[model samples]
Each structure stands twice: as C-alpha cells, then as structure tokens.
Target: MRKIKLKSISIAIVLIALMLGSCSDEILVEEPRGVFTPDFFTTELGVQGGLTYLYQSTRSIYGFAYFLNLGETGTDEYAAAQSADNNFHDLDLAGQGNLSSTSGFSIGRVWGTSFPAINTASGIIENAEAVNLDNSLIAEAKFFRAFYYFLLVQTYGGVPLDLGGGELKFNNSVVRTSVRNTVPEVYTKAIFPDLEDAVNDLPDNPRLTGTVTKNVARLFLAKAYLTYGWWLENPNSIPTYPEASRTDPDGNSPSYYFQGAYDVAMDGINNPGPYRLLDCFYDVHVATNDRHEEMLFYSDRTEESQIYNEADLGWSGTDGGGPNTAVWMVTPNYTTITVDGVSAVQREAAQSYGRPWTRMAPTINVFTETFAEKDLDSRYDATFVSSYRGNWDKGGDTTPTITAANGMEIAPGDAVISFLDDYDPSVNYVNGGNLGGGEIAGRSDYVINLNEINRRFYPGLWKLGTYRTDNAGGLGSPNGALTRPFPIAKFSELYLVAAEAAVKGASGSMSARDLVNVIRARAGKWCYDNGENEPRVEDNSAAMVAATPAVVDIDFILAERSREYFGEGYRWYDLVRTQKWTEYASSYEIGGNSASDHSPTVTNRTIQPYHYLRPIPRSQIDDMDMSQAEKDAYQNPGYQ
Candidate 1:
C-alpha cells in the first residue's frame, strides 16, 4: 500500500472552487499545494471540502479500465479479447500469464486509494464532532469509510484498520508498519458499526445529487450482511487469508445475517425516499436519463465542466486517475466494418459507437443460454449494440449510395452489419469475407448468426458506451473517456437481495419467487426498441412473470444478476460471494480471435481454491516496514 499522508489544504480549496465553478459556464484551473495543520478540518469549509474529495476519490477505481479488468476479466461474463495485453491475460487464468503478487493486475488501486480516503474520512469524522457539524455531514464521512473498507475486505481478504495512530484514527504522520485485521474483526468493528450509524444519521434524501442517503446506507448494509452470510456459510470450503475462522464475532449464525439482509432490503423497498425502479429497463441505462431515480449512488462525471470532470471532455490518451474509459475494453472495432467495400460504421461520440480497444469479449453462453429469452426480455436489447448503421458521411466518405450484401443500394444511416438475434440456418455464410460469419439472402446488411459471433465481431456494450453533447454535425471525439456517470448502486438490486436472502431460509413476508417476479415484471416493459431503432410500446409482464420458476435457487438469482448487471463490474464479487466462480466459469465457448476464425473454441480456466482472494499487491508488501518472512506471510497463500 502507498503511504497515506495528510492531504494539503490546497486540495480542498481547488475542489471547492471546482464545485462552485460547475454552476457557471466558466472552467477554473488551479494548482493544489499546502501542508495540513491540526486546525484545518475543524472549520466547516475544511469538513465540506474533505467530503467532496472523498466523493471524487471513487473515480480512481470505478470508471478506471485497470480496475474494471480486475473485476470482470476473470469471471464468466468476459474473457481476454483478441488485442488483450498481459494486464488482461494475467487474470484470465488461461495460461497466458500468471496472477502473482508481482503481476500488473490493478487490484492495488483498491488497496492504495482506499486507505488514503479512509484516513481522510477519519479526519473529517474526528474533527467534525469537535466543531459541532451536523450529524448528516458526519454520516457522509462514516458512509465513505465503511464503503472503502467493504471494498477492501472483499478484494484483499483483510486489511489494516489502524494506519499509524490507532484503529480508525486520523494519522497525519506517515506509517509503514501495519497489521492485517481478521475479516470478522474488520466487519464487526468497522464496516457494520459505521454503516449502521450512517443509516441512522443520514438524511432521507441527499443534500447533493449522487451523495450518500439513508437508502444508500441501507442498501450497502444489507449487501454487507448478505456477503457476510455467504462467508460464514463457507459452502465451498474456500480458504480465507490470515487463517481466520469463519465465525461472526457477534455470535450470530449465518442465518442471522441472511435474515438481517432480507429485513434491511425490505425496509429500503417499503420506504423508498426519492428512489424507485424506472418504468422501463431501457430507461435505466439511457445516457440522457442517467441521473434518474433508479440510481442510488454513482461516480459522477460530466462533459459540461472539464474542471469538475477532472479530465478533458474532448480527448484523453491516458486511462489514469479520472478517465471513465472502462467501456473501451468491451467495445468491438465497429469502425472497421464496411458495406459495399466502403467503410460503413464510422466511430462517433454517441452512446451506440465508441473507441474500441477489444480487450474483453462476452462468452457465447451469454447469448445462447443466459439471455436466451432475448425477444421477451428488453434487457438484452438495451445492453448490447446488435446493429451497426452506415455513418460514412460523418467520416467524410461521400459515397451517396452503394450496392450492399444483397446487391441492394444503401444510403447513409442504413444498416451495415446486423447480428441475428438467433441462429438462422438459411443465412449464407462466407468463411473469410468481411470480418467473420455470413449474410442473409435478401438483407441489405451483412449478418452474423448468434453462434457465429467472434472476438473480433461481437455486440458492443451500448449501456456503458461513450456519450458526448458537443458532437456537432460530424464525428466527434469517440476516443475520449466516457463522460457518463458510472453507476455503483441501483434501487432495483434491493429486490434481488431480498429474494436471495429469502432463498437462503430467511423468513419474510414476500416469498423468493414473489420478490424475483417484481424484477421480471419490470424487465417485460419496453418503451424503446434498441435494435429496431424506434419507439416501442409493449408489455410482456404476464409472459415474463409466468416464466419464473416456482422455486428460486442461488443459481437462478446469479443468472438474473448477470442478465440485469452484466459488464458493470459486478461479476467477480457476485461469483466469489456465492463461491460459484469455479463451477460457473470453468469453461466458456467463443470463436478464435482472428477475423476469419468463426469456429467456436472451448477455453478452460484453471481456477483454484486460493484464487478466491486476489494476491496481496506486491507494492503493499514491499512498502510495509517488516522483515522478508513477515512479508511472505502477509501475502495470500498461493501467491507467496
């Protein structure tokens, strides 16, 4: 872990200026420098500025590509793409590279950034009481502290609660000596208490948009309970770090935590404050509707103010710090697609098309099995870009009309490439023509059947794609970092949490199937047809609710989670919490990386028992003031 030092007072000044500047059209540029004094945080300005910095710190993890790779690459939802580097291959566990303490995996970001934020939160919390700051403001600090610890415990097993001074103390001096806390100790002492206090002290509504609220605290507290319940059960016998027992320190059984999770989730659902599910599933992900009521908390980003955005709105060459570029990893290279030997889909700074790095691709089972009900479920259409339209004019290619796949004349805005919703045997396949797969007989666009999807030519992630308001009449900056906010928590997940807990034998008023039916019913509503590119008014609620199984299981809930939250950096945590990573992701089928290789390749991942907790980052181990033996012992079992 990097040394946690006191942030200079100038950071607060610069952040406050940016916050104030966001209200106007002017952009402010300022350099932050100065040392911290004991009296700094006692003032109201210091406390508020520290709080703002805490919210901004999330950008280092949430929208970053490296951290996204750690969360999604090793799981069943995605695998290394054709152009993936060692940063991706190391985590795939497919013999491309080894995931060791020395590997370049970005798990270190969670460790390195969280501690400093925790210390900052600690500083605000400790001094705010002295200054008689409102409890709600202090509650925000508590919420952030717990949030970072929750992320840490999940990623690195157990981390240091005491940084230099004491447990949860605000230390201004640098400290290299550290001790790992037990998972139970970390949860019982830090996470649970802080979140419980936050739920009590936080306001019903946020004072600022995207700030923590009572419901956000409740959501996380319930999720923490659910995850702890799974850890206590230890159903798969996965080993934990620091060699601790799988018992809650409070003497509660796993069922108690499960029951706790269900009750809390139900509370949030019953008394939702300015939060409720969006009517249609498509609305939840639409770029223009990003700040809708469904999102509980998110890492905020904007193209309106470059100062508040903390990165350039037009172009970004680096993925460091505040760039929201994780979407680039999953986007297919649509600009290479052609129609009638002319480049058809030019890259644009729109939600449908973005810069493509081709670092990760979805598994074939994602289309064939997990989302088999593509037509009835609007989520599949909302989640992916299945059609590439001709925008050659935007790229200055003035070929007004050209003969397409079926010798049909096509103009601009016509379909260039369309992925079939299901396999069509009548489609005539060309082995090496275009990128991959075949074309339909009478269609003007080239078509790739569902089974023929390859690494080079799969559906791009539409939900998390690029969005820019400044693209005026031409191809704008598709290479820029996505300016949309990356949602971290949503209100709809409460239903899933309640249902999962109910399935785990937590007695509740709503049955497991009843709770799940709520989400299924929502999935059936559609206001927009993403594939057809038109408005659609349809409700298949009865059909969707009827399809639900009479009995719900963990596997069912996991599948629903994938359908609801695919490629959103939630897969690894979900799989690890349920101990389903090995069973579900042992093998996946996808075509070879080459443009012409459409044949499915069965790739097997070598997941082991100790791979559950990622190796302790080598930087953390090296920076600690400990002997070589102590460092070796501090590392996770397999890595050492």
Candidate 2:
C-alpha cells in the first residue's frame, strides 16, 4: 500500500507517456522516444520502474476525494459540505439527480484512472516473460489489474476488456480490439483469472503494507463471487435483472458465483497467522498503527519519503500525510474557539482541522437509525468528533481576513460540535450553545439537530481529520501532499463477507448471527463510556435475528456494513449490491428540525434500478472500436 514514488517510476512512465494514451482510446506511440522501452523492461530497473507506475494507480482508486465521492457521498452514509453544484453530491442524486457519464467527478475519473493502470499492469504481465525477475512481482502486477477491473465492473458494468501487452502486441493494436466485454465475461475471463493466477504467485502471508498477499487476494476473490451473485444474477435469489443476464457472455448459474464467494471467504476467514479484528474500532485508523493485523491492504501516502505531488499521479486529491484529507473532512473554520470569554492568538493554516468544506457529513440516519442503541455502541464516539477545544496555540494566520486573535481558548469540556438527535427549539437556535464570546452560542449553534445542520458546517468524522499534536495540529499550510495513508481493504470486512454469504445460503457451521455477533462484541468492548469493556450482546442469535431487516438476510449484512465502513467508501457499492439503494433511501427524510426545516437533503434524491451500475462514460463509448449498434449493446441497462 506504500506508494511507489512517481520520480523513481517517471523514467518508465516517460516511455509509456510518450505514447500519450487517451482515457477513452489507447493511442500509444508506435515509435520510441526514450530508453525505457519494452526491451528495457527485460532489465531489473525497468521491471521495477513499471511496477512503480502500477503502484501509482492506487491513489485515485483509494485517495480521499475519490473515496468520498464514490463510497460515502454517493450513498446515504454522507452528504457533501459544498452546495448542490458539487459533483460528488450529484452522485447522491442517482435516482433523479444529475449523474451523467460526462460528469468529471463521477464517470470520467473512474474510467480515466482505471484504464491507464490496467494498461500499465498489462505491460508488466505480458513483458515480464522476457525478463528474469521474481514471479511474485509479476503476480503483483496481475493483482493490480484485477483490482482495477473490479472497481470498473462495480461502477460501470461490462467495460471494454483490454489485455494487450509487449511492444507491438498490446500497444497500438489494443484500441482496435477493445470492445465492451460482458459483465459476467469480465468477471470470469479477466478479473477472476488474474486473481487466481495471482494467488498462486503471491505468498500466503506478507507483512508489508504495500505488497500483494494471498489474504487480500482471497478476500477480493470472495467479494467478486459475492458481487456476481448480487449483480450478475444469483440462482438462489430470483433473477430480477433481465437485461444484465441477457448480455451475460458466460451464463454461469447463480450458485456458481455465490458458492465461489463462499469458498474464498472461508479461505480468508481461516487464513493462517493472527489476523483478527482489533479490540478498538478507532485503532483501525491512524497513521502510527497503520500496519495493524486488521488491515489487509491500504493506500500509503509517500510524500514524507518520496519526491512528488498528487497531480503527477493523475489524481483529484493530494497525499494523506500532509493536508489533503484534513482539508476535505475536518471543519473548515473553527466553530468553538472561545471558552466563556477568552481570545486565542492568530492561527496558522497548519493548525486548521482543514479549510472546513464540510463536503462529507454523515447522514441523520447515522446518528439516529444506525445508533438507535447509542448507549450500547462505542463506535459513535469512536468515529465522530463531537467537539473541538482550541487547545493548541494559533501561532499566526496565513489568511489575514480570518484572523485568530489573542488566545484561541476553548476549555477541554467546551463543545465545538455536539450532535443531538432530539431538538429542543427553545435553546436550539438564535443563540445555539451558550458557551459565549457571542460566536456560535447556545446548544443550537455548537450542537445542532442531526436533521437540520448545514452540509458545509456539519459534524466532523474524526477518521479523515487528524488532530496532529506533532506540529501543533499540523505544519504550515494545506497542500495536496498527504500525511496519512488511506485504507482500501481491512480484515474486518472478511467477517462481514462471511456473514453475508452464510445468510444468502444459510449453509455453514457458523450462522449469519454468529459471525455478526463476533464483530459486535469488539465494538461494545471499545465503548467510549469511560472504561466500559463489555459485550452489548452475548451469543444472542435470536435477538440479532429480530433486529434484522428480514430477521437474518442481506439487509442485515448491509446494516452491519454501514456501521463498520460508513465513511470509508463502501456504502454506494453495498447499496447497489443489495438492490436496496432506493428502498433504504425512501425510509429517511431529508429534513431534521421537527417537520419544518429539514434540507431537501436526500428526500428529493431518487435512485432508479438502472442506476445500480453507473452509466458507461459517453466518452468511453465514443472511443470504442465497435459500431454504434455494438456499442449500444455494450452499455449497461439504463443509459442512452
């Protein structure tokens, strides 16, 4: 998961870059302009250089902006802080909102970033045969290609399957051969085969955060099978998606997919070594403890050890180690800077939670529905930062207009943001949280109703915004360079996957409730209610069943996933897979403040079934080698 420095890999990229491949079409250079060529890859440095480029692809797929837009914001899990014009917010409008393929934030980035990475991986996989390198490196290349294609399939079903390689084999000729492969074909032909080969080549257990190990491969393979059961049409479940299956090149039975998922999940669950869930859910994140046993794969920020900026990697966001993530997820401006009556000094840009865009706020559903048993759940406190006390000195202001005067003194107990589901209007507004200096007064200002808060000035999730006491919050100003690595995969997901698959078939020694209860036990023990380390529910299978959507089924799994991976970018995909995007969305209203002042929020939001898979980029279809008729055939169910 550690990034391969772009500088170290630029030499190889130059050779590839000389071709100037288009996002929609593979218009590679027929002639070479650099020493880094197909022949160069036969050497050790060339192979390493190519592998480095492959590593760079993880940024866009796992970066902060990409994660926020695709996973959390697209679903009901979060709302972007910006106004309606923000591209990420449009995705949340999937049913009736503007979510077109041409939207730069939605389709273009997903299509644009993935294809190039797939092409890079193809080069390494095809050319590695000419060189004498470790087969593990070649396995790593396949893992990346499979991983990227999976992302594509999940978003845009049946994308053009490109697997060209070598100097002339896959280079210039690929565009002519690239046609939209069927969703099932893409899974069986490209994605699955790659991972199967990769599992054989990679080691059973790898400790490095960046390496492709057998466990992640097993996890992904299981995920693919699960996706196949859900999307490609499962046999056990009714085949409701007529159009998707009619186009299925491989008419594999539903059991073929689900059973495959079940087997791989079991492999991952029974993985050798001490790979277990961490006691505290909060410990799963944070840079210092990044390589914990719970993590299977993560995107590492390389700014501290590497020479580069985010743009060079073709990403929308910068490194996590610096200020990229902090700016997006933290409060843009300090909400509680004074305690009773006191002043803080001029603030440094580094001391900011971030230029509080409030782009992604957890939905009212999170504070209310998800945490109905708030007293029993420790994850609520672990995940959200309710308030901030300006404990650090605001050294100086980088932006003079927003000056930090004297001592920015909010006492430890002072509330910056106290999320309250229950609204008491008398003290709720006008003078919000009466923690006075006349700025953000009364409970109404500092602590707003979950359903009434503005998206931009929303309650913050601590996962994205780090309070770095290291540089007195942070150093200098915010830039694209990252300070923390973004996680892409975690071992905790295996438990959920196992639970879901078991429920789908109800065929294992461990019941669905059995698997879910194990995770709940961990969440309870880590409760922030003082030193309360107790299980909220013992092996209470009967109770767990009653609390489910169908008293033990896919909906139950989806609910658990919401609690586990809320802002981590798995929400949208989960909604789509369960076919519950619209159903679940309809249950929550967009407004909070009683019935009068809730934002249109998600109520105006619509999710037609066709929106399950994103529209194939109009640009991608235009660039394909096929005729209009063939291209039309390639598009997923609901787009022009």
Candidate 3:
C-alpha cells in the first residue's frame, strides 16, 4: 500500500520542470516566465507533473464508473431532481421490450477521455526510456495506458488499436485505424504485455508511500483479465455482421472476444498477486483512507495526511460527502438504518451541509425485498446502513449540518420507515412526508402510497433516510439538514466477484458450493423457531426472521448478492453479467413503491444477446463519415 506524498511530489514536479526548461532560449526569450517545450519537460521532475495529471484523471467523477450508476437498467437517478421528464421515463427498471439505446450517458465520454489518457501514457512510455527513467515509474504509466484501452474495448467492442503512440506526423490524416482488433487480440497485444512489463519493472512497493504500486498494477491486471474472461465467455449472440461481405477480414465476432476475456481473468488471478479479499467486512474499515487488502487498486484521495476530500460517499452528505438526494428520497420508509450504533435518527441534522448528489437511486424491484429476512446477513446491514443497532452511528455521533452544493440549508428527517417493531407495515406511511410544505418541504412532493401501510415512499429519503433538524429548511440554504452517512465500497463485492467467476468457470458442470457458503457464513443470520419449536427449514416462514446456516447454491448466491450489495451499485452489473436482466426486476412481481404491489404482467425471462452489450451510442454513428448503410452495418448492423 503505497501512499502518495502530495506536497513533496508537487514541489518536485515544478522545480524539475523549471530546471529542465531553464536552458531553452525559446522559453526564456518568448516569455521569460511561462514554461514550454519538450526540453523543459523531459526530466524526472517534468514527468512528475505529467504523472500527477494522469493520477488526477483516474479520480474524475464523470467517467464510465459514475455514469454506469445512472445508465444501468435499474434505478432512475435522473428523475429525482424532476429533471427526467422527457428522455428517461422508461429507464426506471428493465422490463420486457423496455430496453432503449438513448440512455448511454457516459459512452461518448469514455471514448474521448480514454484516448487522452492513452496518448499521455504513450508519451511517458516512449520518452521516459530516453531519459533513463526509473523502471518503476515507466511501468506505472504503461499500466495506465493499458487500463484506458481495456475500458475502451470492453464498452465499444473492437476498437482502433492506437499503438503508434503520440508521434503522429504533421501531414498525418486522422483516419480510423482499419485494423479494429478483436477483443482477444487487444488483450494479448496491449493489455497483457503492458501488465507483464509493469509487474516486472514496478517495485513491489512504490517510492511514494500512498501512490499506485505493484499491487495496484496487479489488481488492474486482474480486473482486465476478469473482464476479458467475461467477454470471451459471453460473446455477442447474433453476429454484428453475418454476410461474408459484412464481416471484417479477421472474422472475429462478439462471442469469440468474450471467451478470450475469461481466459485473461484466469491468468491474472493465478499470478498470486498481493491483493486479497478481506475476511471481516465490517472490521476492515479504513475510513477516510485507503484499505490495503480490500481495495486492490484505487486512486488515492488523501492529500498531506488529509484524505483527498473528494466525495465518493454513496449517500448522505456529512463525513465529507457530496449531494446524493436520490437515495434519500426513494429508500422504503420502514427500512430503518443505524449510523455507527445510534439510531440514524439522531444524526439527521448534520447530513444537510454538503449533501451528496441525490443521483443513483435503487430500483424497488431490486432493493425492496432485500434484507426481508430478519436474520438477514450483517454484511447487508454494514453495506447499507450507517449503523445497525436500530440506528446509524460510526464512532461517536459526529453528525454535521446538511447543506446544498450551492450552500443552501436543508434538514434531515426521520427514517422513511421504522423497524422498531417486527417489520411494521405502518412505518412507511408514518415516514412519508408532505413534499409541498415547508421551505424544504416544497422542494419535494414526498409522494406516499397511502394504500399500503408498509410501503417505501416515491423519491425516497436521501442519505439513509435518517432525519436531521439542520435540513428542516430548503435545499442549499444555511438552514438545510445534516444527513451524511457512511458509503459502502469494499464490503461483500470481492466475495461476489469471486463467487460469480467460480460459478461461471464451472460451466454448469461443477457445483460452486464453497463460494456461496463463504458468503452465507458472512451473511451471519438465519431463521429460527420459537422456544417451543425446533429450527427446521420447513418450519420457517416469511415472518420468521433468523440467521441462515444453509448450504449455498447459485440461486441463493444471487439473492445474497442482492441483500448484501444493494445501494453500493452491484445489482445492475450482476444481472447483466448473468444474462438475467429480466429476472432482476421480474423475479419479484412488485413494482413502483409498494412491497405488496405488482406490475401488470410483462414478459421478463432470459436475456436477449443484444441486451448484453448496449447499442453503440447514436452519436457514434453520426460521428462516422461512411455511407448510411455502411455506417449502419458498422455500428448498428441489425438495423442495416
């Protein structure tokens, strides 16, 4: 776990840039002050600044990862601020025939940013060697270059392999690279080589204490391989081009690429990298800092002992989180969460200031039935709640005032639902608020389904639904509510990914029992009979809450993943990867806000192959200069 020394690195980069550029007459004569030219930035010091820029790119909030949350066919975060009136009404959840190509929010951004990073990395790879650079530093840049490409291929399928680095000739025309490498070829030629080289050149430990290290590179490799395995194993259903004239000369199809992806994953994991899964989800807390085993590789947020104050906090506004009003509004009312050990109720006041983005809400189809069993897993509790003992607390109650990004005030209110008694039905209604009332109240409709006594409110409460006085006023005013809560990151996901890979690797022949049980054991609760009765499986009913000590299976693992990784953003991907998009929402009859409610019958069965890969963005098609039919054949062949 290398730590980044921000202050020292910052100073070193500037000084090095100056020293290296000091002899440049052009720089001295042209502006005497401004630094320019390759000569001025060719040294280690100059490279540090460039490297810092690369590091900063990894931490951006608007890339594929962030937009993935919104575009995934589950929750509709766009509808929260009342902004989703036109384009996204149908994206609430994936229904039969409900798929659309318009929601590819970050696809274009991913395409653009990845190339800049690729060029930056290529520059480092080429020039660093000329300067006799440290092998470790060079390895870091190569790893990033590969990482960017990995993202590109995964989302856009075969891409133009830009191996020429950044030295394009002045007369070079910008032509689409004709050799659109297959997914397998890309991994073998670009990703794997870069990672292997990185592992060899990079030190096991980084020179800076908290920067990207050998282990981080290894993790990136692991992810690349894992995703490659996924793509290889689950290739495109119908070939993008079926006719001889339509197919590329390489004869590669979607399925061929996906299978290669899986093989890459096996290679990465078998390498015995330093990263390992954390045994205890709750105890492995590295609040405000990076975790060693839990996060195999991550961009460091800490600066000069102060964790980079970036807002990665999923929900809630305090604990230095950003505005996340979506979760605050949609979480069911009866589902009470505790912060630390205290009732999340107590800390509602402080979550208002710097309220997290209310973006990214949970789909009722996916999240409501979660944690239905009383003896449900503790990991689920830790993953979603700020606290567990009938409240939300993390150390002492350090609840802060909730405020909007615009510096306006807001208040945190009571839990949308109260679980004080045995899953009481009335908690939902009682927790529902009048959205058209106070200064803060007027901002929301606070819609409630009066028909169902135990239903989650529409536009669910943000930041775990813990109420606070500070947010009693309107959003963004000083009088806002303080509703910050803990964000879930490295909890059960490692287990889930491991479980998924194991199950898929079985290829439906081998049983993946161990993988599932390991998760259930951590789930840590089971249904039990009363003192008069024995704890038998048949004796348990939906009302009976107890811990689960049963053997794990594939079906049960999916359910466990739902319960454990609810708000942390795993459900959508899980469903897509398993080819079970319909099942994600269709498994449960209920739709909308009520637990007892159900949508009109809609056919939701096994995933259509086209559903696996989103339609290439419409903008991408418009970007091409080819004929209408040729462009259609290339980007949207089915339509062609």
Question: For this target, which candidate reaches the highest TM-score against the unseen true structure?
Answer: 1
Whole-model lDDT values for every prediction? 0.83, 0.56, 0.40
Instruction: Compose the digit string of candidate 3's lDDT tens values, residues 395-500.
Output: 2344543332122322334232221212223222212222111112322211222222222222232223333332333222221321222232332344444555
What is residue 59's positional error in candidate 1, in angstroms?
Answer: 0.6
Candidate 1 lDDT by residue in tens digits, 254-357: 99999999999999999899999999999999998998899999998888777767678777755567788888989888777765678778889988899888
Tens-digit per-residue lDDT, 139-169, candidate 2: 8878888898898888777665643332112
Quickly count the clashes in candidate 1.
1
Sequence-dependent TM-score of model 2: 0.78
TM-score of 3: 0.61
RMSD of 3: 11.6
Scored by lDDT, the top model is: 1
TM per candidate: 0.95, 0.78, 0.61
lDDT of 3: 0.40
The per-residue C-alpha lDDT of model 1 at residue 19 equals: 23
What candidate 2 gets wrong by more than 4 Å, as runs, is 1-36, 64-66, 80-84, 94-97, 163-169, 172-177, 234-252, 303-352, 395-413, 421-427, 433-446, 467-481, 527-551, 586-602, 621-640
lDDT of 1: 0.83
